[model samples]
Structures are given as C-alpha cells and as structure tokens.
Target: MESLLDISKAEKKNKLYDSITPNRFKRTIIKDWQLYVLCAPVIIYFLIFEFGPMYGVQLAFKDFIIGKGIWGSPWVGFKHFERFFTSYQFNIILRNTLVLSIYSLAAGFPFPVILAIMLNNIRGERFKKIVQTTTYAPHFISVVVFCGMINIFLSPSTGIVNFFIKQLRLEPIFFMGKASMFSHIFVWSDIWQNTGWAAIVYIAALSGINPELYEAAKIDGANKLKSIWHVDLPGIMPTIITLLIMRIGKILSLGFQKAYLLQTPLNIDASEIIATYTYKVGLLDAQYSYSTAIGLFNTVVNILLLIMANQLSKKFNDVSLW
Candidate 1:
C-alpha cells in the first residue's frame, strides 16, 4: 500500500512538472536548432512538392476550366467520381490493378527476406558482396532502359530467353505479346530488380542483433538454423512489419512507367492498370477532373489500408508504423 501511494505521488509530481513547463518536444527542437536547420531543405521540399500540391486536390471535385483556374472553378460535388465509378471500364481497371498489386506483393515480398537470410548465413564476405552488387545493380537501371531490355530479351524471334525454350524442344513464346504472361513477367522482373535493394534494411537489422544472444543460443546447444529461427528472425521482424505496412499503403500505387512501357495491344487486356488508365484519360484525353477523382479514390483506399494494417500489426505483434 505504501509502494502504491509512492507511485501515485510520483505520477502526480510528474504531471505537475509537465504542466508547469513548456513542451519537451519544442524544447528539444529549439536545442537542436542547427540539426533542424540542416533538415530545412528536406522539410521545404516536402512542403513544396508534396503537400503544396494538395491544394489542387479540390480540382477532383471541381470543373477545372483553364480560363476559370482552380480557385475560380465551379464545384460539381461527386459528378466526376460517380462517372468513374459507373463507367464500363471501372471494374476491369480495378480488377487489373488489384490483381497485379496483390500478385506482385505475394511474389515479391518474401524473396528479399529469404535472400537476406541466405546472404547473412554466408561465411564468405567477398562472395556475399559480389552477390549484393550484382543483385542491386538492376535497381539503378532506368525504367525505359529496363523495359527495352525486357522487350529485347523476351522477344520470340531474336531473344536469348526464347532460345533456351527452343533448346528444350518447346515453341519460342512471344512473352511480351501474351496477356497471360504479363503479370508473371511484371512480378518476376520487379522481384529481380528490387530483392537486393529491399533486403538491405533486413541485413542492417540482422547486423544490429546483439552478439551475446547468439552466444547464449550456442551455449544452449542451438544449431545455426535454430539460432536464426530463434534470434535472427525475431530481431528483424519489426523491420519486416514496418516495411509490410508501407508496402500495403502503396498496394494500389504501382509504377506507371513500367506498366505503360510493358503494355502492348495484345496485352492491353491484362496490363490496363489504374495508373495507365488515369494517364490516358487525364493527360491524353484532357479529362483532368475525372482522372483526379479516380486518383483521389485510390489514395483514400491506400490510407484506409495503411490504417488497417497498422492497427492489425499493433494488435497482434505490438509492431506498427505508428
């Protein structure tokens, strides 16, 4: 009872102290003003390039006449949004977008983790560095160049990939031209390009694990596999959860350039994602308000998914983006 009284008194004291003082956060910021000054450019960049443009999001609801301008534009409420929702292309585009996103997420998410674990297990540092360099190099390739390379490498008539198929007594397949092959090609290529880069954080997390934990495991007679299962995974699971939440937040916002570049008349049925559709309608057809509405809808879904994922993570594992 005395210990409980002492705890209550301590809490009251802390509350009194907090109430009498300015915010600790503000004080810390003021104390670290120089660091904040150095961070000013990044803050300003986001304020300008990221949040600044949000003012025009109202254009999604307004009839954005060139002459009238954004401020002068007349509001149409949900006219554009309703139009997009009720359009013939709505279901098709949404399905294609969701399918591609989910497919890519399922296939691409785990390979990096597996790669990181494998790479961590490697004893030879030189070979590991070489593997990391080779895997990470493709991520630096420009979208246009990467798409071009995909086209050339997967070409039925001239590509080396098809040559291997011919060697197995199979027909030379026109992979880029086939609708069925579109998702496979897109997902696999994305995995290949990003796995190494994505594993970097996991590798860092693994590196940060306390050596004493491994020593303990060894003292317990735990084998290498058991040590990894018991120590390594739990250490990096936070990173995995955080990254998963972020990726969930971007589930709909697939790269427009790669999908657009990969698209062909033959594969349009499968490759017509929301981004490409938005591009065609917004820029090419000059339906700005309608496309903006669609984009806003996509963003709203992402926000909701992010919240849901964060909540679930926190509830189940005490890990979340928040």
Candidate 2:
C-alpha cells in the first residue's frame, strides 16, 4: 500500500511539472520580449529571402514554363537529372569540381592553423601586428582585380615571372594558358588571399584557452612544441573539426566567379567546373529546368556529404554540428 502511494505521488509530481512548463515558458517570453524584438529583422529576412525561395525548387522536377507557372508545369519525373547524368560534359564537369575543391581543401586548410599557432607564439606584439596586417591585406583584394593581377604577372610577353625565365636563358611560359597550371594557380592564390583571415578564428579560439593549462604543461617540463601539440591543439580541436566538416560539406561548390574569371580557351578543359556549366546552361542557353535540376543535384550531394562528415566526426571525436 505504501509503495503504491509513493508511485502515485511521483506520477502526480510529473503531471504537475508538465502542467507548469507552459506557464513558465510564457513568463519567460513576456520577460524577454525585447530580445525577441531585436531578433525579428533577421528572422524576417531569412523567411523572406531564404525559405521563400525554396518554393521554386520544384522547377527541378517539372517542365518549367513561364506562361504555365510552377504549379501548372507538367512534372517530368527525373528526366532532367537523367539527361544530365548521360551528357558528355557530366564526367568532365564533375571531375573538375571535385578536383578543384579537394585540392583547395588539402592545400589551404592547414596554413591558417599553422599561421595562428605561429602568431600566438610570437613574443613581440609589434612584429606580430605587422605580419598580421601584411598577411591579411591580400584577402581584401577584389576577385576581379586579383585575376587581372594574375593575368598581368603570368603574361609571357610583359610579365615579371616570365622576365626572370628570360634572364635564365629559358623560354617564357604562358602560365595562365596552361591547363595543367590552372589548379595550382587557383589553389595557391586562394591560400595566399584567405589564410590570415581564416586564422583569425583559430587565434580567437587560442585566446579562450585557459592559461593555467600552459603553466601546468611548463611545470611538467613541456617545451613550446610539446605544449602546442598537447594543450593548444586539443583546446581548439572542436573548432577545427567543425570547420573541417563544413569544408567537406562544400566539396563540390567551388566559387564560380574566380573559376570563370580565370578560365581561358586553353585552360577550359581543366577549369570548366559545375558552377560555370550551370550558369552557361541556365542563363546563357535558357534551359531553366535543366539548370535547376543540376543545382538540386548539387545541393543533394552537399547535404549527403554534410551528414556523412557530421556522423564520422561524432563517431570518432564526439563532436558534431547536429
């Protein structure tokens, strides 16, 4: 009888707790109305510009006709997707996109971390600031301007790079015209442009690490490299993993502007990526449905990659975006 009464009391307490949760939530909303009001614009902006546009994604599956409208357009049931898969350019575009994205990730990801660590270890504040400014200045250069600079520097006739080659009694190579050199130029230039800006986040993470850990490592006779290997890396590991996952998720979404700007007839074989292909087919050729299908396919691949990366990270490191 006593046991039954205790169980009943526990059930009653749970019921009472559930009943009061809504009232508590309502009270919190009333108290925090100003905070919600401040966030309203951002919420409204996303709803209007982001979520609102998703309604048209159905064009990917339909024979989209401007006169007929999205709802009235006849559903084609994967016809565009099939056409894209069987197209001759499919393999080339996919290969170029993956190769460029992977190359960029592999070449560019570590530089920022290495830079942040080096900057954090600097003893002189003045030298650090100067180095930081010099490194970060490239990131502010406009993409178009950067591409123009690349063209100027790599020009066989009047370029500084070819000037050195001529001085060495060698033929001046047309760097921008070589299909083999496109990926290298794109990746290295991107690294140079973005490394310092990317390092800022790691620097912020390093700052938030507890100073006592470093002190303790020193007490244990750990040197600079050892401390960094142990305390510094481990402290900022979650940030690193999060960023890595994000990068992997965007493995196919190479920037269209840079690739398109850098593209030439000679380099087109290696530089014609999915983004440029989509633009040509969508706007240039006026194949709206086809382009939409390609875009949807790209999005689906990204989503899958994101989920896989998140899952793998969670399994190995117990860190995940979800």
Candidate 3:
C-alpha cells in the first residue's frame, strides 16, 4: 500500500509539471529579460520616492511631535479635518479653486481640438510648422519667467497692451491687479501656452484615422467643413473623451508654481488655491499635522473625482481608466 501511494504522488507531480508553463515565471523573465531590466529603474524609483513615504501619512491624524516621531505621536482622529471643514475660509478657498479650474478647463479643452482640426486641414507644410513652432515655444518658458513676462506685458504704465489702449485714447487699466480679470488672464494664458502641445496627441489620433473615409466623403460631394464634421470629429472623439476624463480627474489640482508666482495682495482672493494654501500651511507655518490632514483631504477628493469621471466616461462612451 505504501509503494502504491508513492507511485500515485509521483504521477500527480508529473501531470502538474506537464500542465504548467515549461519553466513558469523563470522562462518569462529570461525571454523578456531586457524589457524587465529597462523597467527595473522606474519600479525602484517609485518604490523609493513615491510609495516609501506613505508610512508617514498617519501623521495626518496625529499630533506629530518631532521628538516623539510619527509612530509615537498622539492620535487625534478627525480633529484636523474638522478644523478645516469648519474654518471661515473653507468656502472661499474651495470656490477660488473650482472657479479657476472650471474657467481653465472650459476655455482650454476646445482650443486644442480646434487647433488640431484646423492644422490638419492646412495643405501648406511650411506655414503649418511655423504656426506650430510659434505656439509650442511658449510651453518651454519657465513658470517664474512666464509670470514675470505677464507682469511686464500687463503693466499699466508701459505695457504694449496699455500702449495700444493709450493709442485709442483710453485709460491704461491695471489688468493683473484686478480680481475679476485674474481668471480670464489665467485661462487664456494657459490656452496660449499649452494648446499646441496638447494638440499633438489629438493630431496623432487624427493621423491614425483611415484616409479612405475622407476620400469617400469628398467623392460624395462633401465640402471641406462637412468632411471634417463627418470624418475627423467622430474618428477623434474617443481621444477627446479620454483626455477630458483625465482633465476632470485633475480639476482641483491647479499648478502651484504659477498660482504662487502670480499671487498678490490685489489678486489673492481669486488666486488663493488649495495647493498654495497647503504650501503656506505646511512649510511656512510648520503646522505639519494640520497641513498633512489638508493634503490627505485633497488627495482623497482627487481619487473620488477620478473614479466618478471614469465611471461617467465608461457609461457614455464605453471607455474608462479602470
């Protein structure tokens, strides 16, 4: 009976080996060794810099005494969140962040698509590259330098904008100093700076579309505009929808550098956003616990927004990040 049982176990082991991959995971690694080697550095970087610090996230709910350390700090539960939620400036900060993001999104979204579509229609290669280069140049400028240029160009005393207004016999208005004008300037400037680069992806999508559709449309008596309406728009709609979902996911995370650089006593109300507020609270005031809590809240909201946006995209267009 013992000999028969040993034979049975040997047969089962052989069957298992036969059913699986020849060398299992080892074979895969050996076959794609170069690809794995290439990806190793990125995985290491994320593990070290991106995910390693997650251990300290608990400080958000702790008193965070430097001497006591994050683990030894006293847990205070939702105290910090309660403070932020009940603060007088909560609504104001939220409003400012949303308004800037929405304004930029609404204005910035369509311009790239329009630019790509129009550029696709251009038959002259030289003129198209010239236009693309001119638009793309602004995106290379540093945030600090870009903001400084804005200040100089919008200066009421000697700005070219004011020079033209003075030529028209009108008073030189201080554009940057006005709260109401901040959103418009920020949105329009973002559009001008990023439209060309953003259009690159859409243009790539348009290129992948079958040229035969355009020829068919042309043969059916469709004009230039009509051809684009029938062929180009539908072909690139997936890319547009995908990009829009990403934009919506990041709706609240406006860039901190530009907002901080552009901030002033005059435009503070409009320019004050969660990113700048988090910076000031965390680094400047040294309220590490409070700042961490606020940051965690921001991250949670962003995740929720991303999930919601993904769901909506999936529902409408059957495309999603998940």
Candidate 4:
C-alpha cells in the first residue's frame, strides 16, 4: 500500500511539472533561431540606446540640480505639473499642438494612400517608376535645405511666388511672418516631402494582393477601378490600420527642429507647440525639471490619444493596432 501511494504521488508531481513547463518559448527558438539571431543586434541597440535612458524620466518628478544629479535631486511631487497647468501659455501651446496635429492628420493621412493607389493603377511600369522616383526625390532633400527653399520661394523680394503674384497683379503673400500661413506651410511641406516615402509601404502591401482575385473580377467584367476598390483596398486595409495607429501614436510629438528653423518672430504665437515649448524651457532657459515634466505630459497625452483612436477604429472597422 505505501509503495503504491509513493508511485501515485510521483506521477502527480511529474504531471504538475509538465503542466507548468512552457513549450512556446522552446518552439519559438527551434523554429526561428535564424530570425532571432538577426534580431539580436536590434535588441542590443534598443537596450543600449532606448531603454538605457528611461531612468532619466525620474527628472520629471524632481527639482533637478546641476550638481545633484537625478538620484540626488529633491522630489517636488507635481510642482512642475501644477505650474504647467496654471501658466498662461499652457492653453495656447495645447491649442496649437492639437490644431496642427488635427489639420496635418486630416489632410496628410490620405495623401500617401491616394499616391499609392494611383501608382499601383499605372499599367506602364516605366512611367510608374519615373513618377515614383520624381516624387521620392524630395524626401532626400535635407530639412534645412527644404526650409531654406521655402523661405526663398516665399520671399517678398524677387521670389518666384512673388513674381507670380506680380503677374496676377495681386499682393505677394508673406508666408514666413504671417501667423495664419504657418500651419498651412508646415502641413503642405510635410505632405510634399513625405507622401512618396510613406506610399512605399502601402505599395508593398498592395503588391502582396493575390492575382487570382483580380482575374476573377475581370471574368465578371469588373473594370480596373472596381477591381482596385474591391480587391486591392481590402487586401491592404490591415496595413493601413497599422500605419494609422502609429501615426496617431506620434500625434503630439512634432519634432522641434523644422518648426524651430521655420519660426519667425511674427509667427511665434501660432508656431509654439509642445515640443518647441519644451526646448525653450529645457535648452534655452535651463529649466530641466520643468521641461521634463512638460515632456512627460505631452507623452501621456499622445499615448491616450493613440489608445482612444485605436479603440474607436477597432469598434467601427474591426481593425486595431493590438
């Protein structure tokens, strides 16, 4: 009886151990060893560069002294946040960031999709390649050079834009100094420079669509436009949703460099976004803690917006980032 009980207990222990052991990790390693090797460098890069600096986020909660460092700094629980909320410029900055992001999202989001659709529909490969190359060339132009070109072209004196206005017998619009024109210039320039490059992913997705679907549509006497609408768009909807999620994720993170370069004294009111505000507080004014708090706030808002957009998209379209 004791020997039989011992055997039963041992069998139960073995079964428990087996149940707790994970198989997915072992299977993943066996199936994807080569892929894992390729990803090792990227993992190391993120570890060294991205995750390495996450500790500095503590600066957001402290009154950081130059000599004291992050750990030695005195904690000022939410003081900076309070100041940020109460400051007169807070609303202005918030409004500017939202307005610019919304406008850019509305106008710029569909451009790459349209461009990809058009490029895919081009039956002549040579003409399509030429068009693609021409559109993509602008992406290689450095932002400094691009902004300079914008400034020169919009210059009231001897600029091509002004010259055109002169021909039309209308006043040359001042693009740089005008607060009203700042957002327009920023959004339009962003579209022109990025639309082609962004379309590359969509075009790649479109290529993966099965040829049989198009053939079937042809048999049914469906036209090119109809085939594209029914087959190609549906095939690439997943990629579209994924990219849209990413775009929404970065809605608040407008890079400071271009806006800073493009900024003029007259346009300051309209041009001041969260990123620029952080730059001014941190780099220019040496208020590191304050800037860190502001940066954290901006990040949280962006994340919330991304989550909300994803949830809404999932509910309506049955597509989401998750």
TM-score of every model?
0.86, 0.88, 0.89, 0.84
In model 1, what is the error at residue 170, expressed in angstroms?
2.1
lDDT by residue (6-63, candidate 4, tens digit) is 9999998876676556784576577889999999999999998999768888889999
Q: In terms of lDDT, which candidate is strongest? A: 2
Backbone collisions counted per model? 0, 0, 0, 0
What TM-score, to 2 decimals, does candidate 3 have? 0.89
Question: Please, what is the whole-model Cα lDDT of each candidate in the order they appear?
Answer: 0.92, 0.94, 0.90, 0.90
Tell me, by TM-score, which candidate is best.
3
Model 2 ranges with Cα > 4 A deviation: 1-44
Better of 1 and 4 by TM-score: 1
Tens-digit per-residue lDDT, 92-118, candidate 1? 889989999999999999998889989
Tens-digit lDDT track for model 3 on 1-322? 9999999999989767854776664776787899999999999999999997798889889998999998999999999999999997778788999999998998789999999999999899999999888888889998888999999999999898999999999999999899888888888888878999899999999999899999999999999999999999999999999999999899888789988888888988888899999899899999999989888988899889999999999999998886
Lowest summed lDDT across 10 adjacent residues in model 2 is found at 15-24
Candidate 2 matches the true fold with a TM-score of 0.88
lDDT tens digits by residue: candidate 2, 1-322: 9999999999988866865798866876898899999999999999999998788889999998989998899999999999999999999999999999999999999999999999988799999999888988999999999999999999999999999999999998999899999999999989989999999999999999999999999999999999999999999999999999999999988889999999999999999999999999999999999999999999999999999999999999999998
lDDT of model 2 at residue 321?
Answer: 96
| Candidate 4 global TM-score | 0.84
Off by over 4 Å in 1: 1-48
Alpha carbon RMSD to native, model 2? 5.2
